[model samples]
Target: MSKLDIKQLTKQIIDGVGGEENIVSAAHCSTRLRIVLKDDSLIETDIVAEIDGVKGSFNNGGQFQIILGTGLVNQVYQEFLVQTDLSEVGKEELKEIASSKLNIAQRILKALADVFVPILPALVASGLLMGLNNLLTAEGLFVSGETVIGAYPQFADLAEMINIFANTAFVFLPILIGFYAAKIFGGTPVLGAVIGAIMIHPDLLNGYSYGQAVLDNTVPVWNVFGFEIAKVGYQGTVLPVIGAAFVLAKTEKVLRKFIPMMLDNIITPLLAVLFTASFTFIAIGPVMRVVGDWMTNGVMWLFFELGPIGGAIYGVVYPLLVITGMHHSLVTSEMQILANIETLGGSPTFAVVAASNVAQGAAALAVFYLFKKDVKMKAIASAAGISALLGITEPAVFGVNLKLKYPFVAALIGSAAGAAYATWREVLSVSQGPAGLPGVIVIRPQSMVQYMVALGIAFVVTFVVTILFAKMSQGKSKLN
Candidate 1:
């Protein structure tokens, strides 16, 4: 590919998309130049596609997006800003403009993404560590004849020590979720952290073990204001913490408005915490627990009742969820599955998701081979495909597959095929990993082969289907 002249490319992009006046806002993700247009009709789609260095273009979630390779997109975005009226605007301002154009459901999904993306790194690390611990303990993997820690009783203590590190994060997951949730909701993060601590105080019953107590009718409750408040901690819970943080933030704002400014410093936080915490314990916490349980049972029912068919449906829709940014909302369900792995004998959800990611990458790889003549396009597709294989799919989906609509559909079909086979084989993942090819790290020893087969099917099926469809489209375009 020729070296990108940022100035020239940026000018072509701006002029082809109807100049600066036509743009409401502009931003770039890993490999796409995302813009919100004031009037969609003003965009010259053919002209934009023909611009030098532009790979493909599409409209999604009210944004007019243009695919450009990762490094080049940022340089083009910077140059585009300088040459246009957007130079003075911050990225956040552009995001706000784009968000203002979304519908109610889309706005909620965006909010969930904002809350979860910041905390994903920590969860990702803890999850990988859990998988590593499982691998080390798996029979015959890291041992001469048997499991490393299981056969040598002397090494048990050392194994337990390592387990502590793996368990700490998930054991206190609510605290982490609360801190991030509060920040997202415009509340004091420290205060939300304190609420998380309160919920998990040593005196309270551990939430993870609460189900047995519930079955035995031995669960503890605190009586306050003639109401019985469950004393179960919110360790692995997600919905309650998020709901609490949101309520706390709104309550604080209301208190600030009514409370005298002179006494604000002393009274506001104290009352905010007291009232919010009380209300949460009394109402919100219990209500959210019911909702969380419903979602958990719903997924459990789907998998157990319908088996492979359920997995097929989940796989087909998951990529579409990722596209709309709604996948973050399902993290709570994933966590619940992980927490109850013993009862479920392992969740097929993670394996299905991993297969979907592989399918997406495979579809992008097919597009990469199709555009072999265009060096810039091939390079972008290859890099995006590799990123997807490594467990990141935004670049592959938005930058390649979705730009050429057929590839995205091909990926979904491939994902469904893989997921059904995986579920039929009952492939199990012990914990979440970075996903995609690296997801092998989380598969149970006995299920590893099945997982690999699922992934291979997803990749091969998507690649062949996408290549055939793209070739057909090429012929149609020539005829036109």
Candidate 2:
């Protein structure tokens, strides 16, 4: 059977939906087609849902979503941009469309950037090296005697220094998040980082370590009320710093707007710093800690009750949380769990999630291979799959699987299989690892072989299943 010309099919699909006239805005994520319209009333979503290549269509967060699987979504997006009037929409209109009260994409995008942008460079460097390192270490190229070369006295010194700077962002994520949060809220990011630094100061951490309590001793410095507060280090934390930064940014903005210039310059910084720090120490930190504890305990209870199945279910839900931008809320909880409990056994859900990401990448690759006759589709699929494999799933999900019709199902099935296997095998991840190749190390060193095998099986299952399904349906003609 001849393959559907992806570009032509995309054009037809767009034209059927009233062309560029109907579209107000459009974007793609790892697995879905995100679109806003001038008037959804003018388009027939049910009709679009029944299109030859479209998997499904639904309205979410005020955007009309067309599920396109993984590999083909980018092709469709590109074709739409070329063949439709959406390309003609002015920048002001695009911004207005994006900022329309009903749209949440901007905020979601910002949050995603906040979490991912800072880590990207380090992630890329470390991820590629980590993969190569695994291969080298496995071949005994980096081994010294029975111990790894990293354990050698000469190598250990340099390795520790590199590891420190490379891993510091993750270790002190709260400070990074505080800076970004301040930027998001229209505040001085540098100031917010300084504030975050103070919260995580070594001296304060030492005080907390010594079991010191808040003492009611006021020491005024620069007209700001200073009281010795109980300290809880914010390094690698998520909630307290973010919460503090959010309040501080708003306070600073309001002060800048209303307070007289002379007083504003001096008084605003003092009040903002003092108030934000005080609130963080006295209220936000404790509350967030309690909340984090509760979440960890709740997940732990579920793990105890449902065992591996619960872990599998969590694996499935975690990605969906990432899609909705709600995953940030759980970062603090996961860190707290790591702090209180040495291992993530009680929360082994990410093992399956890691598999899911790999599965999605595989499914995308399958589509790329299947639609070889369509050069544009093939190119987009390859790029999307590679991106997914590297832990950047937006392009894969928004660009490929959702567009290909059957790949999303394949990804889900693959994830379920991986989750089930990991749960049954009691696979555990110790650290909060990347969702891609580096995550392979999350498995216990002794069980690394089993982890790789399980991951391979999941990817193969998803890829083969999706390719076969797509092949079987090739001869049949369907309408958009």
RMSD of each: 3.3, 7.4
Number of clashes in model 2?
23
What is the lDDT, from 0 to 100, of the residue 340 in candidate 1? 59
State every prediction's TM-score relative to the real structure.
Answer: 0.88, 0.66
User: Model 1 clash pairs?
Assistant: none
1-480 per-residue lDDT for model 1 (tens digits): 333577888888888888888887788877788888888788888788678788667666677888887688888888777887674455566677787788888776666667766666666566566666666677877676688777778877776776777667767777877788888788889888877777778888887788899999988998877978888877557788888988888888899899999998889889988988888878888898889889888887777688889989999989998876678677767766665554665667888999999999999899888887978668768987888888888768876887788999999989999998888888877666767888887777778888999999999999999988988888999999
How well is each residue in 1-480 modelled by candidate 2, as lDDT tens digits? 013487766766676566777776777765566777777677665567456667545553446666676777777776677666455444334434544634465454434345445644553454334333333333343464443544555655554555454445555556766787777666778767877787777765532232233353422122225644454565534566767787888889888887889798788888888878877877887686566557777866655568767756765676576556565555545554443322343235556767778888888899888887977667667867876776666556655776665897788777777767776676655446676655666554544565666677668888989977886677454531
**lDDT scores for all predictions?**
0.80, 0.63
RMSD of 2: 7.4
Which candidate number would show the highest lDDT if scored against the true structure? 1
lDDT of 1: 0.80
